[model samples]
Target: MTDVVAFLPGNGHVDARLSFAREKAQRLDVGFELRSVDYGAADSFEALLDSVLEQTSGADLAYATGIGGLVYLALRARGALTDQRAILQGPVLWGLETRTFPKLMRLPLMPRALTLAIARGPIQRRFMRKHFTRPLTPEFQRVFFDGYRDARAFERWFAWLTPRLLRDLEQQLRGRPELLDGLTAWWGGEDHVVGIEELRRTEAALGQPISVREFPSWGHYPMIDEPADWTAEVARALAAPH
Candidate 1:
């Protein structure tokens, strides 16, 4: 499989996460590449991820998380196995009913218009910038906002798709039974977005040869929280030869 599994980044995240992974591959002396979708209104997350992996010569793994991870699982659950393998890092296995969902959008009383308005405005970026462990480096700040600012174009074009992100997630966890078996990552002791108990229960429910670690120190953005340490593990995980 082409070099190694590629990494698909989460929404609006800039270079730090995937770049950290590249450093890991170099240290491990493994053949691998770190690339992510060039975010755009024209490309759905899965379409972009699938295109990247399809260009490879053989089966290869892909590492993805959050909505990004759900995109990969959506394809696998749908029976489109283009990649040789997939490695889910704290995947969005379930629990996305409120984030971006079609059913909720269909609900007459859902305040989606207001939500989208908030997300499209500076309000969302301000909130995002606040959540990071560190302020986004000034350089990333420019590029990050540049892309985020253009999200209105997408909101107009993909209005219906906004809620579907969460629906896609909930389906994989509840409707699809094929998501959990392939690969793994550290669960959590008290994950906020993805709880420790739910993660473990999801793994057990799948009942397959999956590997996971439980770390209380890290949260959802484990790579950002402990890049060097997580990268070391990811490097070894990739070297194992899927």
Candidate 2:
């Protein structure tokens, strides 16, 4: 039996989607606990990392999906987490850094203001939905909507997503290839939120080969899109020898 810790996506808390891990654990007759770092409550990436470390101190393995995967990588790179093996689903590596903005939005003051504006309910909902290749169920809709409505949360998220932070993260990962030694990553070919280019960049930055599984039709949220497949991957990771 293995004790597993699952981290929620960037704007999410522990929710029903994580129940798939619980169910998988039961079937495998292994120990499993789902934990969350409240990204909404964090004032910055440093605070978010602190919360994750504080919350998930004694787990045997880490399971992180979406941006949470990236968070796990950051925590591991910083030596904040002790988990020997990690399962990362749809990790958002260099996507944030490569995001394109309109010429007008690039103007001073307009960028932050426009980001804040889009972080509001209606626009945020539309933007969040764009991450998926297919439509979301009602349950996921509520989850996404709730995340979008938390304006302060978006503020903190944006604040932590600066170019400086990206550079720091790259430097940390490149400087310590051992940080990514036991990671297994899953990526969706259809994922609009994180591109293959980002995955390649992540591999390059790691300075070593990484175990990655690619699903051609899956989108950004594979657990939501295909829970059974996601759970199966988790089980495989759990069963693999570290």
Candidate 3:
């Protein structure tokens, strides 16, 4: 069976948020796979980048969110996804003007202690609850807490998000605008995490209009807020012609 591959965010958790893609794959009778690299294990950022490139090497249809979306853009810009379809949800390509989390994580060793503190059970729950619309499910919360127990997960994600890397990705996409033809962007109208400005920067960098689907009432976690609706939308996108 063909696969509907999803590249997960930095935490690398196969959490409840991915069920939308899994259900859509089932409706299409395709396999579902969650892809993630251990940023914590990589010796250097280049190694992590290479792993991400390899993880997303080839796919008929792919789903990526946040940092994963950035990885997808890098691959697309490099001509690695010429004929594949990509569903990018809340891609953080730019728009860091107001966000302090990414900026703080990129700091020196001081952030390690901070990341570990945030990884603690209570803090993680509070942070996640803020982003989600509804209460967290037991299953979802279990995996989420388990996934971030290792502080390095958070540490390496920021390590990979250096300004130099972001600049290089923007330059590549701008230089080869044709490479992004197969991308479809999904955004929650109320999403504050990767808000409208980030989406605009993505379009500006690619130099082409992106196909976008906006969810009026949803925040950053549409799958957690309205799983069935998001799953149906995924099905529609997969069934639609490329």
Q: Candidate 1 or 3, higher lDDT? A: 3
Off by over 4 Å in 1: 15-17, 23-31, 43-59, 99-136, 141-147, 150-181, 188-193, 197-211
Residues 79-113 of candidate 3 have per-residue lDDT tens digits of: 77668888888877765433687787677874556
TM-score list, all predictions: 0.62, 0.76, 0.81
lDDT assessment of candidate 2 = 0.64
Worst 10 residues of 3 by lDDT: 30-39
lDDT tens readout by residue for model 2, 35-70: 654554676678778877776567666767656676
Compared with the true structure, all predictions reach lDDT values of 0.53, 0.64, 0.67
Residue pairs with backbone overlap in model 1: 59-84, 60-84, 100-163, 100-166, 101-163
Model 1 lDDT tens row, 148-214: 3344222332333344654554455554445444556555443456654445544454444356777
Q: Candidate 3, overall lDDT?
A: 0.67
Q: Among these predicted structures, which one has the highest lDDT?
A: 3
Order by lDDT, highest first: 3, 2, 1
Model 2 misplaced regions, further than 4 Å: 12-31, 101-136
